[model samples]
Target: MKIEHLTVQGCNEWNEDALILNERERIYGVLDGATSLSSAVGVETGGYLASRIAKEVFETSELPAGCAPLRSLVLMANERIRTAMLERGVDVNDKNALWAAGIVVVRIGEHQIEYAQTGDCMLVAVYKDGTVRTVTHDQVDHFDEKSRLLWERYSKEGLPPDEVRSRVYETIKQNRLKTNTSEGYAILNGEPELEHYVEHGGLNRIQLSSLLVLTDGLFLPRKSGEPTPSMSDMVALIDEKGLSGYVDWLIANEYDESQQGKYTRLKVADDKTAIRIYFE
Candidate 1:
């Protein structure tokens, strides 16, 4: 396979995002780490620690000799996160106190592509016929939509960035509480029910032209009333402009003097991570 990848920090002091590429194991993926609102771990934030631990497992750990059980690796990572949290003295039962991340990973085989996803990290496939389809769902889309609307409302009311951030914090907190539950999205957050939320699947390799693995930071900013960004549009943009082209586009328009960034996106910037893979 031919691989082109990118990982970059946004406005945050630490790049809480990470990537996983193990050619020997034929595995590749992306992780979007998010720290708790009040978390401030010593050297690295909880988000960084969580994603970093998962990245290490994917990159250095051994898989079963013949099979690529992607979900097993995720479960291992989740278990490790649970242990790490306790070591750090975080209340595992308190979702708000523990770090979390959305991960999407895949193992490409000669005849099939196996994948596992939790949270909002995405897997998109472009077929030979120029058709594009998302292999996994956007776990955070529902909550993000509500948050985006809140950002739009506050910004439209002429509230400053600081005030808008403050106004939206509560909503973000409430949504954060809903993670790994029936009411909310899926994530690898050291929660007890992670197995139930993990998404895994296989796709015929012959039908695919390429695979794009991405974190939500690569998601295009949409205005309040505009159509939501679709997988087709994302694939189209990558076709016209490479992965780096999309990053350039995001940085160019992410901020302005009047507001933090686009009203649709709640933050000034977010960690960006993505990988493009083409089968041999």
Candidate 2:
């Protein structure tokens, strides 16, 4: 088995994303600290702090004899994050104040691959037969798509990027109420019910070529109407471009004038993180 990973700072001053590559424990994945909605507390951004807390949990949590390691670790991580907020005198009940993250973790075993996820980080499985399936869905896309449309509409009206963001700010705020609720997506926000919404499963080890675990930042960005490339398209891209090369390609896409227009992206870039595991 071989593992490769890449992480780059986006527009943020510091990278909010982190990777889990505990080879001794056979646990690996990606974590996207949910971008903080509020100002930083001291030098640490909420998103970055949340992600780091989770990273600590995965790195040091003991696996109990009767517990499911990945699932338990994720839940524990959430609790710790929430605890951190509480210690900081944060109003944990306020969605706006909650530090959060999206995580995709897999524990590779000799005969099977165990995985768990929440929020938007994803996992993709590539087979030996030239096929691929996105094992984890981008839970935040449905709401984001609405924001994207609004952003595009405002941009078409010749609004500046700042104006467009202002126009969509309320919608984005309203979407926060839905987080971890029935109408919204799951995230490790230290909410107790988070475990109910976590995505977990196992895959057979045989004939599996690789597992691509990444954050949404690693997704190939598209214009308003351009179809999101399929799982096969993405894996094939990584094959051709390689991990670092793929990130460069994404950066280039963001800068490509031909791709910019009525539906401009909300941000210039995001903290990109990814881990690819190849089965040899």
Candidate 3:
């Protein structure tokens, strides 16, 4: 098997996205959200601090179960962000306000994959038979009439992104503040919906070209009228074009002149990232 990854600033002032692929350990992660606008770490960017510390913890830690590992990583990340905020003189009360949402993938064996995520960064899985599916569910607020009505109301008062997210999950008594809606719900409410399978299994027969991990920047719900590609779409694309064609398509589709600088403007261009894994 072979793994390839690329990270780009995507017209932002600072690279807020972070990704890691530890083939030796069979783990991969992509963190797209930022704690602040200026940096990934240090006094200026607590968000950076959060992501770096989380990545380090994940790289070093071993989990008897993938969910346990991911849960620990998120907690540690929150603490790291808290520490950085204190050192930078940010009020302790504000620490909880800074949250880092991401998707984590852990390969349990040559044949199995375990994943946990919050927010929009995604994991698209492709089987050997050219069948594809998304392991991670989208966490965006639905743009239905009710949601649109709420968005319009909130847009006037100007709620922070985190606040807006919490509001969307308001029916759930505890989806408050900077917590990750998916993971948090699992912890406070119930177990994560684990999707398990034997290593390769059916996939062992077909040639697996890639499993692309992308941040919300490459495909934002509000900005792009185009529907986000379904998992089936990804599988079909890989089957036909393979990695080279997919990469070419991604680069062409994502590098829009009009979209440039949107991230810095907080237009939520987010951050762009791609991880291509090939089964040899």
Candidate 4:
């Protein structure tokens, strides 16, 4: 299998987004640092740490088939983060925590793949037959009674379905109804924890035409009303425009310094990066 990848920082002056690729093991990953909620007592250091740790695991481990190493990687990353803080004399119980949103997919060839996701970053598999499918579950913006109610109210107010996610997320966070320890940061105080998803078998005949992975900046649920494109559309776009061209398109269109999307209030307009992997 051959890979094509691209990465860009957020629109903000400070870009804490990081990405890692281990071509030898056919593992590709991205981590986006959540630095926007400084008042919530967390640092962006976790994102970088998580990315490096995950990359190292992929590079070093000889993971067996059907074994998704995401949970292991997250556990390793967490331990490393905690240990580093202790060694640095930083309070382990400090209100400020560190987190990086990311998604990881390992392709074992022959149209077989497994994925692990945390935070809002997403992974999708596009089959040669044009089927678009999401492989990872979101750790944030989950569905609930209140979220559904908010979605209904906001939808009646002319908000698109995708745009409703952020509003619902904020409502849950700000109202303290979602059990978040920190008023503003879900991951702080452990309201949000990492989630792992795996799909095995049923991958035959799909012919991994393309794999699309993206950070929140490139596919903000509320932005452009572009419907964020399906995995099939993402693959089609990549087919039309090589990885470089796709990166250029994203930068040229989404990186306006003055532009703000519906979710801008809740999300930082950071640089957008995406990777497309094409397999034989």
lDDT of each: 0.86, 0.85, 0.50, 0.52
**Candidate 4 lDDT trough over 10 residues, lowest sum:** 183-192
What's the ranking of the predictions by lDDT, best on top?
1, 2, 4, 3
lDDT of 1 by residue, 1-280 (tens): 7899999899888999999988888889999998877756678888898999999888984665565499988988998999998998888877777788889999988898899999889999999899898989988889888887888888889999889888788888888888888889888889878888899989998768999999989887786678887889878987898999988877766856454453466667899999999865
How would you encode candidate 2's per-residue C-alpha lDDT over 1-280 as one tens digit per residue? 9999989888778798999987768899889987556545668888899999999877764744334579888999999999999898778878877888999999989999999998889999998997787888889989888998898788778988788898798788788778888789999888897978989989898789999999988876765777765667777888998989989998887767776662347777888999989999
How close to the true structure is residue 204 of candidate 4, measured as C-alpha lDDT?
43
Off by over 4 Å in 3: 37-43, 61-68, 95-99, 141-178, 181-210, 220-229, 234-269
Q: Candidate 1: minimum summed lDDT over ten consecutive residues — where? A: 255-264
Ten-residue stretch with the least lDDT total in model 2? 59-68
Misplaced by over 4 Å in model 2 are 61-68, 256-259
Which residue pairs come into collision in candidate 4?
A: 9-271, 10-270, 10-271, 11-270, 11-271, 41-96
Clashes of 3: 4
Residue 45 CA error for candidate 1 (Å)?
1.2
Is candidate 1 or 2 superior in lDDT?
1
What are the per-model C-alpha RMSD values against the true structure? 1.8, 1.9, 7.6, 6.5
For model 1 the local lDDT of residue 263 reads 45
